[model samples]
Target chain A: MVPVFLAQWMKEKRSPYMVLIFISISIAAALLFGSNMDIKLKIDTFRGEGVTVEEAERWIDRLNESGAFIFSLRAEEESLADVRQGRSDMAVRLLKDDYRIIAVMESTNVELVQQHMQAVYHEEFRIMAAASHAEDELEFREAMKTYMEQPPLKLQSSTSSGSELRSYDMRLQLLFGFSLFLAMLTVGFRVNAMTAEKISGIWNRVILSPLTKTEMYLGHLTYSTLIGIVQITMVFLLAKYLFGFSLGHSFGMLAMIVVLYTMTIVAMSMLFTGILRTPEQFGAIFTSIVPIMPLISGAYMPPGTITNDVLLFIGQFLPLQHALDALIGVSIYEQGWTDIYLPLAKLLLMAVIFFGVGINLVERRRL
Target chain B: MLETVELSKSFKGKTVVDGVSLYLDQGESVGLLGPNGAGKSTTISMISSLLAPTHGDVLLRGKSVIKHPQDIRRVLGVVPQEIALYEELSAYENLQFFGRIYKLKKTALESKIQEVLEIVGLRERQKELIKTFSGGMKRRINIAAALLHNPQIVIMDEPTVGIDPQSRNHILDTVRYLNLEKGTTVLYTSHYMEEVEQLCKRMYIMDHGKVIASGTKEELGRILSSEDTILLQLDAYDDAFIEEIRSLDPVRQVERTDQGLKLIIAKQSRVLSSIVQSAERHSVQLINMHVHTPSLEDVFLHLTGRTLRD
Candidate 1:
């Protein structure tokens, strides 16, 4: 096994460009797509006939409090022109007591902004109504501040494990998504070397050696898995230290997840190698199919965004989706081993099944 | 010593190797001769334990290796027809890897690598990548890789298929040295009859997935010992004259050649005289006439009705 693995390493060392290129692409892609996730969406806000500039400014502050969408007060003509000229996706028209969303197209961002505005306005209106019942304005303000500080009805959200659900970071999702997606390519191509070796007769030469079949497979798979882990680690390290992306404090959990995910991916690649006849066919088909996995698994978007039943059901079978779930559970959610054991177990199970079936197919083809 | 007992293999109910039984004695160089698809590669594969025969057993020193292939794999070195070395790796690196897989000690492996390289005459170019080497050089390295472990038996399957004459001679010399000097039993397979004739003491001639004949070169030639091939160089011979030669009482077979006609007839027969008279009567010029001795090729043709390359 060591010799076989060393042989693979020696081959790669002689021509290290492909592996280096994959790592570079992973990091570059994460830097390109992940950088945008941190910036807040900017929406232009303008005053209506009865709304003063001060009131509109106050409304903008209220809307911006969520830190998700930034609402800026602008001249009515400027805001309307920006939307008309396609400079902005949407604009806000603030009235004295209500707000209107003016836009060229409808999108999730527009709907989310509207919902936030409604919630803010409704809370303010309720506070105003409560103040009207007070004897003096000063007294009303003081009592209202106290009540707001200690609200009577507080809604708390927590997971089934009784842990508070942490805020999800879209940047980390994109970072991990693109990194793991590209890592799959690295590991897959490495695994696909099996077929290439077979075609080149190197595989038969190795078989004729005293090495056992199990050792040969283990050697190849272990090397592939290691290459994948290295690619992922390099991308993550670059993202963390170079780009200043926070991967949470759970370094051990992250490492464990990386190993499991890499192994599962290697096994999955073996299954693909078994299905495809030649290295060329495997490269073409595998490359065409891998890029779609992240999309189906909702790796590009925030969780719960892809509501299609079919896509969701299919995503359930993909190792990437489960891996992302475990990774997010560890990094973003800061969940413990108890919380992530299911996804981790699922990954292990997938590795076993895929490796078993894949090796069988390969051996059958050999016969 | 090793032998296969009625070895056969079938793919999807289509038998590719049928009832192939052969043996190799210790320190003896034997040849398995056949054309493409004659089951030579398959037979070698089965004997090397690379493939499991559908029916039969391979015995290595009186033990069946079919169930325990490790027994044979330890002592067998197979130089596949294809150049199986990693093109991206140097020849030395390829040899090193193969040697390590055979569980050779570090120091021993290093020396063995150099020894094999020296044997194949690629010691100086060992550091060059296999892809950079020419076809013959790659082939020499291919043979060098299989020799690193110094197995008792070496199975070379058409190791000189497409190479320069110089490399071909180098490989033939290497095989001869391995068999004669090192006492390594060899099962050399090739369609090139002359290569087999030059190297192998005993040979198996296979056609249509079966051994058509197996014996020493001279012994196999005896199958046609009673027959002689008559070559007639003619100048515009007519079909009637060919029919006349074919009708001779001693003639067994007559085939038209580009030069003229070839006839298989009884040895010491008077057919050549009869043919000359017939040619004169037909006003055809018999430019030359010669009686050829039967070779192993003739035996193969007599038995299979085709040449070795066909």
Candidate 2:
């Protein structure tokens, strides 16, 4: 078994394929992070009736500090033309009481721009209203100071219940999803070659030794799982450092989920290998499933985002989907182990059962 | 010591191995010879415990290996016909992996790999990937991988098939050394009668899933003891000249030779005069001639009425 493990490890170390996988994922994550970072939350603007350019810039400046919007003042005609040309990401219409946020589509940016605009302007009008009701000169001065200190619209307020620090960071979720997808294909292909080796009589040589069935099976499994874990770690780390994808502050919890998820897919790859005898079958059957697994596993759309019930239902049962859920739950939502253990347990159960059956079938078939 | 008792195997209702019982003593090199599809590999497979016998049992040293296979598995080494190796790995690495699987310690494993690499003559390029090596090089590495464990009994199944003459002889010499100097029990299987004839004291000639004959080279040769072949080298070959020589009295069979005719005749029969007279009558000039002893090929021909290769 040690020979089997060492042999596999040595082969992987000697080959360029793992490096290729890293480079491929790094390129992919780079594209994901780079493109996502370039999104223009900045709205092209104009002075509206009764609203000065100074006031518009003031609101835009406050929203920029919130890391929500980037506003640039333009001529009214030029701003409208930019909006039509899709150059301007959003527009704001300042009215007497409320401000209206506009975009071609109601995207996350649109919602955030609206929230930040409301927060900023809500304070400005509050101070104006306070100045109209001051009792004396000293009182008027005091009122203005009080109104300046207190923001009418509180973006963050103390909730009766605790605020769970959540990460709706799309870039971070793509990091998880893309890494998991590539990991599945990478390890699956490697395991398929291993199955081929088993049938090619090289595996029989090891079997001819004094090793038992369990030891041999475990060796291959452990090696592939270790490979999967390493790949995931590298991809996530690259995303964090190179592309600014954060792990939502729960690095330890995300690490645990990554470990469990790696084991699950490694077992799944073995099961996939055991079901077929040849690479052609893997290419025809298993690889056909590869693209779809990510789709259903939230590698493309993170959990609770897919609109179709049937697709979401399929994702609900997939081990990867639960893994994404658990990953997002702990790292993003600051959910404790108690909150995420069910998903973790499900992933573990899937690993044990799937790997056990896969190992048995492969041993029986080889013998 | 290893022994098989009426071992048989069938696949999909087709019997690839019939009931065959054979044995190898502690230090003897025994050969199992047959043509293609003669079940030689199947029988070897069963004996080495790679495939379970459909019937009967294999015993190592007196205990049934099927009942206590761990004892036999520990000391058994098999050299499969095909080059079973990790093409992506180097020769030293391949040997190291096999040695550790056999549970050799770090120091012993390193030394065994070095020693076996030397035995197969691949020690110079032991670090090169097997895929970069030639076919003959891979074959040598394959043999080297099997010898690292230093097993008591080694079973080689056509280890020299499709190799260059140089590598072929190297492998043959290595097997001889492992058997003679090391006293390792060897169960050698091949269709090449010359290899078996040179290396084995006793042999089993299998044909069509059964052991058709089993005996020493001399003992098997006795099947054709009544006759001997007369070789006549002529200045040139002729068909009708050999035919006329065939009709000569006491010349039982006539076969064309590269330069002349070969006559098979009974011992003590005076056929030299008829063969010489026939060559003179045909205006054929005899270059040289000699009488030769029977070989394993002749024995196979006498018993099966077909050449061992055929």
Candidate 3:
């Protein structure tokens, strides 16, 4: 049975398809990283000449104390893409009197940069007034100060788009969810294939043999988990080596969680097969369910952003949410076993429930 | 020995197999004969424990298999009507997988796989993937996969349904070898009467979920002893010729077909010559003729008023 599974996996390898998925992820990551780099360079240049690190640090400290980091400028009005492309950190207005503070990033991490901009604001404005009386320096400064003081209730920040935590560890939540997805498909497809054989008559050969249902189920689950572990470990290696992601949380603990999660998925698949009699039905159900998973999983999108009350409610019952939460703790916070015990316990509890429900459903078919 | 006592099953409110009783002793061969929708597969499924009988019981070695299915399932091999081998795996790989399932240890399992592959005459092509195999090869491997464990009682459900004559003959020879040479009890099912007549010693005729008749080949054939079969090939067949053939001496009934006419006669030899004589008188050319003694197909036609193929 074990060899059969290995042979089966070898037959399904289709290495080229996997390579395509990997290439797509790499390309997406590179594009996002490049865009971030271009924005970083533009902000640096806007800080202007000979702004010493010490002066920047002092200015940043003041801005941090004041809890404000504002950017205001004026240029020929054009597309939002152009405003962003020139790598301007905020929206810029080139009014006759003064520029408007359309965007602000609260000084949380880079306070010194905010301070350097504030220090040179008045000097830059005065130099512009000397060249042309098209703008009043005092009035322009006052307008800019008022704008910064009020700073429109909502502020858009560049840091918000990326992983907000500087540590690579926090992204483990995404990796964990991805691992769960892999486990779901692997185990589910195997179970689907096996059940299809049962319905289509191949199982008769095995049924009359010494192999009991327990052995068949165990053999498949064991092989599926092994495959899942390999896939997950590869994703982690890629993250660590190629993408610089963290995985310092106890590998043992993560393995334990992953095993439970894999079992849960396997059990869920069994339940699905029991409910849906044919492979076509299974395919339909799997497709319908897979797209909705990432939302509950908080893999590509966080559960917090999901405003639909029903989806949020459903998210709590979903295995992905608990697994993702545990992942965030273990990877992001570098949490110890003590910190993760609660979420891990919940996951195990849910796993038990799913297993019970699934087994009951499948076994009931015997009647 | 394998037996089903009053075995019954229903699906979605329709009784698919009702009150079917059958028994096969050691080394005995039985064929199940029935038209389509006659519940042959359903009965086999119940005996194999692949299905739960709505009522009654199936037994192996005097122990009720429904109560202890694993005991029977361990020794009973079934070749389904459909090809059941995995197309993704090669013939050898499929046999090994099933061999392991039957808990054959490494050394013995290897020897047994070689043995079965040789028996099936596919030893040289064992490594070829099933998906790449021809239809006949696939059918042969399908049967070979079922024989890996050397089962005591083997049930083949319409195994020769859609195979070339050569493969069909190979399968029939294998069945004969398994039953006669190896003392394996066999339960075979098919709609084809000739295969059943060629292979089965005892047989059962089923229709609409009921076993209408069961006996030895001769005994079942004897059920319609009063009526013998006559075949007549003619240049053309018409209602008048059919009526004239029925009115002939010893002719009990007549059925006309495009090729010729079938006359069920009380005395087949007495009427066969007269039918040819009458065909010439009616300006009908007698192309060929035969007197078919009462066989399973006659018994099926007698019981159902429809041929097995119908």
Candidate 4:
């Protein structure tokens, strides 16, 4: 096993550029995609007949406070034209005491923008109604402002274990998703070298040696898994320290998940190598199939966003889904061992099953 | 010593190798000769334990290798027909890896690699990547890789198939040294009859998945002892003249050659006088006429009616 592993390592040492390129691509892609996650969505806003320009501007300012959706004040004609020309998904028409949404098409963004606007308008209307019963409008306004800042009755959302819930960070999810996705490419290509060796007759020469079949397989797989773990770890460290992305968890937990996820990915790559005939076939199929896993697993969006039963059911079989679940559960939700054991176990089971089936298929086709 | 008993292999009911039985004594160099698709590679694969025979037993020292392949694999070194080294790695690295897998210790492995490199005459270029080498150099390294463990028996399948004469001579010299000086048993296969003639004492000629003949060079040459070959060169000849020559009393077979005609006839027959008379009667010029000695090539042509390269 050591010999076989050393041979693979020597080959990589001679041409280390491929592995370095994969690592660089993983980091570059994560940075490229993660950088866009924080940009606020801009929407055009205009005033109605009962609303003055200053009132509309104030409403726009209030709407921008969440830092999610950006509402910029514009002329009513220009706002309507922006939506009609498809420059914006939706626009806002602020009334004196009511709000209206203008758009040419309905989408998830339109729905989210409308929901946020409704919440703000409902709260303001309730406050106005409460202030109507006061004798002095100015005093009531000042008192309401002070009271809202320091509420006597506060509702804090928490888990059943009494820990505060951490708001989902889409940028972190994108970073993990893109990093894992690219790491799969590196691992899959490394594992596919077995097939390439078989074609080139190197596998037969090794088999003719005194080394057992198990040792040869273990050698190749261990190298692939190690390389994968290293790439993911490097990306995570760079993300946490260099890119200033908050991991929000201990390095030890992240390390454990990286190992398990790398193993599962390596096994998955072996399964793919077994099913395909040639290295070219494996490359084409693996590259085409891997990009869709993050989508089906909801890696680009928050949890519970994918409500389609078929897609959710398919995501259950993918290792990436469980990896993301465990990673996000730890980094964002601050879940402990008990909270993540299921996903971790699922990853281990996948690794075992994939490794077994992959070896069987490879043995069956061995000449 | 090793032997195969009635070894046969089939793929999906199509037999590729059928009932091939051969043996190699200790320190003996034997050659397996055949054309393309003649089951030589298949037989070699079965003997090397790379493939399990459909029906046969390969006995190494009177023990069934099928039941315990490790017995033969430990003592056997196979130089495959393909160049199997890692192209991205240096020659020394390839030898080191193969030697390590054979369980050679580190200190000993380093010396063994250097020794094998010397044997293949590639010690100076040990650090060059395999991809940088020519086809012949690659083949030399391929042989070097198999020799790293110093196995008792070496099986070379077409090791000199496509190479320059210089490399081919070097390889032949290396194989001769391994067999003669080191006393390693060898089972060599090739399309070049002269290579086998130069190296092997005993040879097996196979065709269509069967060994048609096997014996020492003298014994096999005796198969054509009763017959003689005559080469006839003429300035110009017609089919009628060829037919007339074929109809002669001592003629057994007549084949048109590039120059004129070749005839297989009874040994010491007086057919040359009859051929000269026929050529005179047909007004054809006899440019040259010569009697040929029977070689392994002739024996092969007499038995299978095809050249070794066919």
Clash pairs, model 2 backbone: A42-A70
Query: Model 4 chain A, poorest ten-residue lDDT window?
Result: A159-168
Q: Where's the lowest-lDDT run of ten residues in candidate 3 chain A?
A: A40-49
Best model number under TM-score = 4
Deviation in angstroms for A216 in model 4? 1.9
Is 1 or 4 the stronger prediction by TM-score? 4
Candidate 4 C-alpha lDDT tens digits along B170-190: 999999999999999999999
Clashing pairs in 3: A59-A115, A60-A111, A60-A112, A74-A93, A74-A94
For model 4, how does the per-residue alpha-carbon lDDT over A41-146 read when each residue is reduced to its tens digit? 9998888888887888878877887748888988889878878888878888888788888877789888899899988888778878988999997899999889
| Ten residues in sequence with the least summed lDDT for candidate 3 chain B | B267-276
For residues A60-122, write the lDDT of model 3, one tens digit per residue.
Answer: 343334323433222334324454574444443323222233334543223444344445555
Candidate 2, DockQ score (0 to 1):
0.54
**TM-scores of the models, in the order given:** 0.84, 0.76, 0.77, 0.90
DockQ of each: 0.64, 0.54, 0.55, 0.67
lDDT of model 1 at position A192: 93
Worst 10 residues of 1 chain B by lDDT: B298-307
- Candidate 2 wrongly placed segments (more than 4 Å): A16-20, A23-27, A30-34, A37-167, A283-285, A302-305, B225-295, B298-310
Report the C-alpha lDDT of model 1 over B1-310, residue by residue, as the tens digit. Answer: 8999999999889999999999999999999998889999999999998889999899999999888888888889899998888899999999989888888999999889889999999999989999999999999999988888878999999999989999999999999999999999999999898899999999999988898899999889889999998888988988898888888899987777779887888998887779889998899999999899877766777787776777
State each model's TM-score restricted to chain B: 0.90, 0.86, 0.91, 0.92
Instruction: Assess candidate 4 and give its lDDT.
Output: 0.89
